[model samples]
Target: MPLLRLIMLALAYLLPLCVWADSIVMVAPRETALTRNFVEALSSRLPTDTFEVRLLSSTPAPDSASLLITLGQEALHWRLRQPIVTPTIATYVTLDGLQQLHDEVRPASVQILLASAKPERQIILAQLLIPRLDTIGLMFSEQQRWQTRFWQAAAIQRGVNLYSRGIPGQDQLPRVLTNVLNQSEVLIGLDDPALYNAENLKTLLLTSYARNRVLIGPSAPFIAAGSLSTTYSSPENMADSVIDMLQETWRPAAIRYPDRFSVLSNQQVARSLGLPPPDDAELMRRIHAQEQSR
Candidate 1:
């Protein structure tokens, strides 16, 4: 079995190299740290001759490139407008963003790497920390109603209850937050600026802290601010996932999140809330194991 598995893995990697071993072009709306970091890390992992960076505003993608990687919404939008025959992989985009892009380009050959954590991944993170997790709370903008439905089903599968509230607007946040906070043991943060922007994040974090409710953030900044932990992937991880998909001989799934992830924790926040936080390495190990089991 071990020998067979090794052969299969070898074939998977080699097949694509044989068929489509050509330069990759990565496009983004603008130059940013994330884009720079992804290109650097991906270059190290892939062949030195295999990748080049192109900005949506400045340079056109080279015709010689076999694969196209787009970062962020602007780049994805730009790609959809063009007639692209090459295989495209989009990263650093939300689930909603992917859906929106697909609406514009159906029968889309472009694959996606969503920024949001999968429901199972988020639930596992919560369950690992709070073993007795019963009622989970979430706040979402009207645009994210689909997420609430997803979590509701996921929670039931895991023997957990989900309490969710939709934010009609930013003005009603305090009232809606108080209502959900009262019913939930942990509050999940979605990656929506309308609901969790810079202007309201401090209020949300402080309120969660005062309520003694565990706040699960969607990104590193949230974990840094006051969230006990956040489930996200870094740019390098995004690059790695994209590279893996491109190394496939055939077109893969149209939409998916990066297989790699990071679980970041703030020990001070955890300690203040009277919770013990797992070390970063240990937490990542557990998360990857959970994903593999699924």
Candidate 2:
């Protein structure tokens, strides 16, 4: 049956294509440079032949989509309010931001890619930058106090002490920061906008600089504004991370930080503190080696 064999071969090829073909819908709160860059980066990398990616403009997401991706917190909130049942991957949200919405009813299947790096990674970076770094300072808002335990555990494992202060309100920041800096060699900025916003970051940097202690762990933008160093993921890095997750046969619903990142340093700040820190490339290599060893 030559005809039957031809039909079977055609079906075999078509079946795999049908099974692999996935439609991905990306939704963002609004059109912005950040969203545009991410979309462009993702589009360039995703295999056009197998994946169909579209930007969602309105609600009632297409039912044919194999997956939905929300670009930011606002988009994610909007999607959560809807009744769509497609599995979603929410990006550009910090751990605390996502936690704030955890109590709200959401879709059954959702995952998050955190905007911040792991606390352990931050601690390790600090340790690498500051030799014999024993005591590390952390100032967190009341909403982020629960995260201190994770930071403390990471510090303890590395034989370093974490001196953390919780700020009940913005008014208490000056006092809390003073106390934390007095006890610790360096301050590690947590990923809380309430504590680390533009209005507050300048003061934090000035205060830490006055104390001759460097600040670490804020994102790349802060590095330009006097933060000593940080590990950050760019749009391309995030797109690659999403690609990795998509390729996985089974991606469980979990909150994860980007596995790939680039290290940045403020040579001026390092010089001002009289600290000779490794260059960005070396620091990244060391961090990678440490992660691999773990």
Candidate 3:
């Protein structure tokens, strides 16, 4: 009937307008596959037409626009008045060159040590990595005024023995690590970039193993390769956190460690560097289900 046809035509045009009712403003690190995927997944999950994703080298302070989703590794920060936050999307702010997680875990009386070529981001990590650690060590390239005070304050609060050995260079770290091992239970944190770029990964890992130290790094691949363990935040969970934060507009100035992924012991890596992992019945079942569900 002509009357029925007219009604259908009007509904078609109205449907699209109704679909998009909200919007979120996203600011993340420059350009990368992960960033692209984050935009796609987040946009799809949002209740908006255009979830306007803006790419910037750094995430600036929040504006009066829509919700602010920042990804500043560790080099950037913002001044924000705390507001109610309903974290539905896993939005991450990569400030100071470090990406964070939706959750955090604080270990017991753990010793946290750091070695980085740079100061800003490295110092921030050291502080975040501090409360969880019982002892904190500083081996950085620049010991500017702020660096000294930061380390000093952390030491007083935690009563951690703050040891500062000059930044160690390549082929020279194994010996330095050997010396430090005599005092601490764990050697968690990155070796100075001056040393990392100066030496090969194989050498660094081998040295870490030789010292029987539990090495922890921010880079995921390094953890899989040989580090004792690492705190990780997957893109999936990050997406969830971002949604939650955006739904209620709040950027709580805090850091969170990602989920914990088990590491391959030195013994395990030695067993089969080329073969698939040893079959764990429970693990395999979970893996199979996850795959089949997909």
Question: Model 3, which residues run further than 4 Å from truth?
Answer: 1-21, 28-30, 48-50, 56-64, 73-172, 195-200, 247-267, 270-294
Cα error of candidate 1 at position 16, Å: 3.7
What C-alpha lDDT, on a 0 to 100 scale, does residue 253 get in candidate 1?
42
Per candidate, the number of residue pairs that clash is 0, 0, 34
* TM per candidate: 0.89, 0.87, 0.50
**Cα RMSD for predicted model 1:** 6.1
* Model 2 score (lDDT): 0.78
Provide the lowest-lDDT 10-residue window in model 2.
9-18
What residue runs in model 1 are displaced by over 4 Å at the alpha carbon? Answer: 1-19, 249-253
Question: How much does candidate 1 score in TM-score?
Answer: 0.89
Candidate 2 lDDT tens digits, 202-266: 77988999999989957888998889999888888888888776655434457788777789899
Question: Runs in model 2 with CA error above 4 Å?
Answer: 1-21, 49-60, 106-108
Candidate 3 lDDT by residue in tens digits, 1-294? 366544543342334322322444665657678778766776777756646766554544233332345454321222122231211122343222221222333121111111121222223233332235454444443322224554556456434565544443444655666665555534444433444332456765676566554444534456567753333345554565444433332223434332211211233643433323333343324333433463
For candidate 1, write residues 201-268 as lDDT tens digits: 88898898899988888678888777888778887777678767765654444678788888889899
Model 2 clash number? 0
